[model samples]
Target: MVPEERDGRDHGEERERPRRARRPAPESKRPAPANRRAPAETRRPATTARSAARSAARQLRDLTGHDPESVTSVERQRDGGWLIGVEVLETHRIPDSTDILAEYRVEVDDDGELVSYRRARRYYRGRSEERT
Candidate 1:
């Protein structure tokens, strides 16, 4: 009946309608937030050669019970892992330390953990393996 009262009701009605429509759009994006967060794994990307080699060294010390002396080579495997060749001081001797240099084949998963490893070769530290 009153002009002021009519204007207030009209304004109230307009506000309510938009709120109802926009509510669903935001809820749709709620599920999308999970998808957005999934790319976090992708954002990190794969491991680098340096990091893989370091991992190989640390793991070698733990698995082999010997300190890793140095890294010889690093390569990326087709199965989304790293293959690293590590040289460890297996034997510590005086004057001419009889070193057992081993090529440790290392493989790391997506989570940056050592999934698998094995000794590829065992050789002396002072002497280099002659590749023919």
Candidate 2:
């Protein structure tokens, strides 16, 4: 009588088939996460005209190192941006009327970045322009 096989495989096949060895994937040099920019760089979209005006005023103060008094006007541009008018306090005086104030036209992009700014007019706090 033939002897019973100890392994599960048939008598014709090898007892144990060897497994193919796998090579590890090589590591590639990638930029570190610290080099990546913050989400703030993506920027927040400008929502309302009032909010844009406020943002312009705050940005102007930071750029010019002056105190912003009030927002004079806010106009929407064709590019979905905003042309904001900001009134900044240039100098203070005992008589409030004599205080120096300036009007600046600030262009803010849709991404809330200050594209450009220029001083449109300057006058005393009490002075009012004659509308034509």
Candidate 3:
């Protein structure tokens, strides 16, 4: 075959040169260095004392009637459980005020189960009891 020329250039010379291979598209849009860590790797799971305290508070509220006046204090025990002190703020038809103004000692396990419960002390509604 005869070589053809256009504008004083040889078409055969252009065809003889090798064309560049096309590159593959990048696997991800984000740059490699910035996207290296997965979402789970970047963030740590959270645990806190406040979360435990709040959980204990919710448990106490559920066990006792949702009476704001009933619960006096809540404390976390050394064994990772809860110690809740509840006051008998009001009672219906009980003759002795001591029976009405009792203090309930509630023990809750780490999983918020009622481990044990009892009336620790009784006092008159209008008077304090002397400890012996």
Candidate 4:
């Protein structure tokens, strides 16, 4: 029994079996050169807040037939867009009230497209209110 168990093979000998050779690393290929310059239209600078505001006002006037009174504020978003607040002196023909002021929120993308618009808030023409 002892002789049978002592056959020449040991755990260490089994562990010494040769490992398979590793494959060589692949070579990186160079990228192909671009065919031609990008179109000139693609090189224009992104639209800014001032430009967007001007364009939005123009569009609003064209669509609503009223010239917005003032641009209260313009904010640039992280995604290269703008939020413009315009104050328009709109007259509400309610029975007792004469004129009412309203604010419109205009959104424009970097390409100067009007993405969205809505009325943010409204207040009396002569009253002052805290900004949210």
**TM-score ranking, high to low:** 2, 1, 4, 3
Q: What C-alpha lDDT do the candidate models reach, one value each?
A: 0.70, 0.81, 0.58, 0.72
Q: What is the lDDT of candidate 4?
A: 0.72
- Residue 123, model 3: lDDT of 61
Candidate 1 lowest-lDDT run of ten: 14-23
Q: List, residue by residue over 53-113, the lDDT tens digit for candidate 4.
A: 8977777666666568889889887677888888766665454234566788888888878
**Number of the top lDDT candidate:** 2
- 63-130 in candidate 1: lDDT tens per residue? 88988878988877766777777777766766553555566777776545898888777766566573
Select the stronger candidate by lDDT from 1 and 2: 2
Clashes per candidate (backbone, < 3 Å): 0, 0, 0, 0
Model 4: number of clashes? 0
lDDT of 3 by residue, 1-132 (tens): 987546976645656568999887678654457656557545322323344445544564566653324666677776667777766543544555443456767676666666776667766665656421
Worst 10-residue lDDT window for candidate 3 reads 43-52
TM-score of each: 0.59, 0.61, 0.41, 0.55
* Per-residue C-alpha lDDT of model 2 across residues 1-69, encoded as one tens digit per residue: 998758765767656778989775545434336866536535345567777887899899999998998
After superposition on all CA atoms, what RMSD does each candidate show versus the true structure?
A: 11.1, 15.4, 16.2, 14.6
What clash pairs does model 3 have?
Answer: none
